[model samples]
Target: MSVKIILAGGGTGGHIFPAIAIANAIKKQQPDAEILFVGAKGRMEMEKVPQAGYEIKGIDIIGFNRSSLIKNIGLPFKLLRSFVQVRTIINQFKPDAVIGVGGYSSFPVLRFAQSKGIASFIHESNSFAGKANMMLGKKATKVFVASDGMEKFFPAQKIMITGNPVRASISLSSITKEEGLKYFGLETTKKTVLVVGGSLGAKSINEAIDAGLEEFEKNNLQLIWQTGKIYAEKAKTRAEGKFNVWVNEFISQMEHAYSAADVVISRAGAMAIAEICLVAKPAVFVPYPHAAEDHQTVNAKHLVEKHAGLMVKDNEAKEKLVSSIIALAKDEAKQNELKQHIAKLGVSDADTVIATEVLKLIKK
Candidate 1:
């Protein structure tokens, strides 16, 4: 009989992309697998999941507003309504297994699945676990993690250090640097810096880069900048008539950006780190200060401790980021050292490993 699986969770690209990678891996192994995605209504996944060519169901759910208590007055109603929606989805889908990839939407689906004795799995991509995932871990059949020491968050016996799944376009990219530069309408002779601040963009990073555009030009460095939506117009205005820079709200083909880059500036989100490590580029990270449990800093610190990457605090980016990138650009030896060290941490087949294990256990 064909197997059916439900992959749940997604608010950001970090969660959505990994879920898509896992779905693709499952399809590769089980051609007849009927896969479905579940995400919070109106969230990015509702759109991104379909773009990935998978069917998805969205629950009327939203996470609690930590910054503004008044914004959460309707939280209980939404949660209750989402559980009802989840029950209908579970009853109809009757999935063999449910996988949660760390988003508020996943909680209801996985909880209902576990309550029904359906095997449920979780993929926690952060060094510090989210509260929802921690609660879900107790009953989870398996918890896949990106790094070691996750036993403190999940049940020791139930954890697997499978690493975060990188999007295949990045992990398996064969695009040459010259071709990548040409794709971005940039010159191969100039060193290129790729700046990415996640799907929503990073305000501090954007402001810093904007302030340092002339400095980058002065150093003869080119840039391929993904400004996300909010900063797109301002970035375009800043880059006007500048042949050395390419600016876009989003770079749909990030493989090209990775190939073209001599150095990278990025937020330390799990998927971003995984992709950067896979690409083996020298990077300087600006971890978002407000991430839950300050996890982004923890992620960057782990690499910095191993000499795998450099970091600048978000608040310090405007003052220190440009100088750091310029310094690293001039130091080829440091670049190579970082490249070699970070490359060692990349896992190219995490999607396959997680998919195979989930399928194998369910079949038994």
Candidate 2:
């Protein structure tokens, strides 16, 4: 019998990439599996999921506006409308299982699936579970988590410790440092620092790096900077005459960037941390201070406590992030120490693990 499934998530690369990884892994195991994706309308998943060759349906869904209650007036209506859409999709598709991968869309999809007594699963990629995921997890067939001790949020019996699924391009990348440098038109002899502020550029990190452009030259270093779309033009202008810097709004080839970097400065989102660990690179994390429940800080702290990575407060990034990354780049011993510790935490086959579990659940 053909296995039919629905994967839901999307707002950032963090949610979308892992969802895609799981989708790809399921297809690998069950070549005839029918998979569909549901995401919030006008979100990044609308574009990204299709690019990965999966058909995705975008419903009118938006997360709560935490900054402005006034803007949330129509939110209830949006939620109701999204639930209707979810019901229609579920009824038409009649999926054997529905998986929520963490996003606004996931909430409604999984909620409806559970209401109908269909098997529902969740992949909570963060160390701290989101309010929606915590609520849905009670009835979920399984709740896959990246970290241990997530029982406080989800039912203990249902929690499965499956690390965040990293994109296949990164986990299985064979790109050599020399090849990575050549791809970016940089010299292999110069140490490289890759700065990524997530899919949407981090304004503070961008400003800090902009202020420290000359420091790279002073230290004889090259840079591969992914500035996200918002800051691309200004970032490009800043790197205009600099031969040592390659600045872009987005990196379609992240594996190459990771391969070329001796050190990385990144926003400490769950997926970012997952990718950094799998790449086994020395890193300086600057957690986004405003993240829900300040989870990014918690994510970074876990690694720092284990000596797997170092962190700088988001507010302090301007004064500290670049300098910290530079110091790490120059300290070969510390870099190797971080590399080995982080590699120990890396889970290269999370997609397969999650896929296998899903199949097992379906069989039961």
lDDT of 1 by residue, 1-364 (tens): 9999999999999999999999999999999999999999888898889999999999999898778999999999999999999999999989999999988899999999999999999999999998999999999999999999998999999999999998998888999999999999999899999999998899999999999999988999999999999999999999999999999999889999999999999999999999999999999999999888899999999999999999999999999999999999999999999999999999999999999999999999
Worst 10 residues of 2 by lDDT: 314-323
Deviation in angstroms for 44 in model 1? 1.4
Model 1 off-target regions past 4 Å?
none
Q: Deviation in angstroms for 82 in model 2?
A: 0.3
Cα lDDT, all candidates: 0.95, 0.95
Cα-lDDT of candidate 2 = 0.95
